[model samples]
Target: MSDLFSAAADELAAASAPLADRLRPRSLDEVVGQEHLLGPGRPMRVLVESDKLSSVVLWGPPGTGKTTLARLIAGASSAHLEARSAVTSTVKDVREVLAGAQARLGERGRRTILFLDEVHRFNKAQQDALLPAVETGLVILIGATTENPGFSVNSALLSRSVLFRLEPLSDEALVALARRGLVAEGLFSGGDGTTEEGPDAAAKAEFEEALEVLAVAATGDGRHLLTTLEVAISLARSRHGTGVSGEQIVLGIPDVEGAMGAKAVRYGVD
Candidate 1:
């Protein structure tokens, strides 16, 4: 009975998760955008494949996959992963992680990766707490920051780490992401209505046109693109009413415009 309850709770949690999270790519291959970082022979791809990453920083704009990439790359390595947010973490937190990492290294010959998100928020003293562990390889620091590290990071710490700049996603990448978002929302049909066997001709055309509008508004941010789609999907269900079994909910331009507060003028007559 407890096991069944546990499974039910897990299912409830997954059902309530945000669409963008639910849509997160499972493998590096499924990941969209960042081809420059993950392409064949790219530095990141090489490091992940070889499990040889050192202390490094990922610099990128919002929604460009900083946190996602950090988790993916670290998961590929053999080291134990510990994540903390600079926004809420303190010098004490940093010191504790470092000490634990030291103990782990001594006892098991294992490494720990401290993935510090929004690392620019860490003050000088908090960062200082990490320097020794980072320098000695007691912990591999994977710092992610939206701000320029040269200006925000300590000069000494910055020098010891590799920095990779992640660019805003391209238009093509955003489009692909929006399509995946559609499938995740179960909008086109029960199955992913992407190919010829998916949605009918007219429905697919409307879906493509609506996605194009979102791509323009997304401004190379995948998160923004997907959030809008999720809202639009909600608006569609609300507008159509519920309990309409087996009827595919179509997400069209008007639905997107409503979600985005876009005026009818934004998209001229068909």
Candidate 2:
């Protein structure tokens, strides 16, 4: 009945959410990789820690942490964040956010951070509509895009914002992330890739080896790595029956390969 369906949906929601979001770093300290921008004494880190951020554009390939960085900045900033996706937002939406930003600044002496995901999706006119607010600092723009802003964003709008490039997660970083993920899921006991001593030793060893292989296969895409890991976990659960999960489950190279090959899962943390 409706009650049964609702219960099923509630159970599946967390399992189905994009891995990047479910395992999202809660604080700047929890974030891995991107040391160049977030390392000690880095200008961006300094600015964010002090909450003195200005209009900036985050440019990077998918799964490189553009959205994550924007959200963190918004949390740390002195401004109110008004997030939107250019893929779904029209000029009217942009105008509304700008108006809210203006009113907020005028009435309460506050600033606003407009974090636009896929800002490159905005057409010339739509991009232009954001210019006045950005230029005048009524809204601190934090535009996230996979495309090059120089080509996709309006020249006028692009010039007003500081551009920060995010690099893809390196293999080492991805491996570290994989280990962290296993720990988070309770598949591994600790960050050292050690099991909790109750799981089968052979199975644990095989799973660890498979994790390395999968990490390399992920090829610098953290979202892909994490999402595929979730799928592999599900496969292990099914293969061994749901009674055994997390630490006691049996997963190996075959599970990873099966998850990768079964279907194309486009869901991710971008």
Candidate 3:
């Protein structure tokens, strides 16, 4: 019976994994942070609602969900989504993407959203190659960069795309995301403390603490927080004979100490 239960638990966790990850939010409301972008009357909100997104730039530090937001924008639009990473893509890749966009336009009469991740990594020559496509509506460029685009991106290409700055996620928002992750995974099955008993007080508290510290360490980057939380949860479950007990969870002092030492100030807009 113990072996059977263990196997069942493992299967459940495995099955739950994809759904939990996928539930990461397709819509802006589903997104945990970045309220500034999703908030009413915001330019991003208007674009998403109107499906009128154009060539753009997403600027922020690593793990701040730039890639995710860019993808979401592409998904939200009727335009074709084409992605290229500056670190690996060459002028040839740019030309190919442009060609594909042109082909799609001719075949389906669809627009294109060209997402250039780590755009700041591209040299002047690469940026210059994209100017014609971006300017002529052959491609709607969505550039993402960990560095400052103004310093690295060509002035002409930079002038054409609207720049959107993304900030880091806050401890509270990170914690909220973590809790949602748990609930979404069906790991904490229960009703209000009165009903099914849900997650125990100790378990909930520990998860909150772990999430808070992890988020602080992530420095407002939602992707970083999610990845770290996933790893921590996996590790904790492994230690507890795959049961995922609160005691099994790891909490780093660097994160805890950091969270404790810092003054309370919200990071991400939402």
Best model per TM-score: 1
lDDT, model 1 = 0.83
Candidate 3 lDDT at 159 equals 93
Per-residue lDDT over 1-270 for candidate 1, one digit per residue giving the tens place of the 0 to 100 score: 999999999999988988888887767888888888899999888998999988989999999998898899788989999999999998888888888888999999999999999999999999888988888888899999999999999988898898999999887788888767767665663234543345577766776677778888888888888888889888878876776412366677778899899853344444
Global lDDT of each candidate? 0.83, 0.81, 0.72
lDDT per residue as tens, model 2, 10-112: 8799777766778888777778788988999887798899988878899988888888889999998778988999999999999999889888998999999
Ranking by lDDT: 1, 2, 3
Ranking of all candidate structures by their TM-score, best first: 1, 2, 3
**Which tens-of-lDDT digit does each residue in 1-270 have in candidate 3?**
999999999888867674335555777777777788878898887897899877889888876678778888888899988888899999999989988889999999998898888898898889999999988989999999888888888989989988888887777777777666555444442223222333456555554555556667778766666666555555455554654544333333233444344443333325
Q: After superposition, how far is residue 158 of candidate 3 from its true place, in Å?
A: 0.7
The CA root-mean-square deviation of candidate 3, after full C-alpha superposition on the true structure, stands at: 7.6
RMSD of each: 2.6, 5.9, 7.6
Question: Candidate 3 has what TM-score?
Answer: 0.77
Q: For each of the candidates, give the backbone clash count.
A: 0, 0, 3
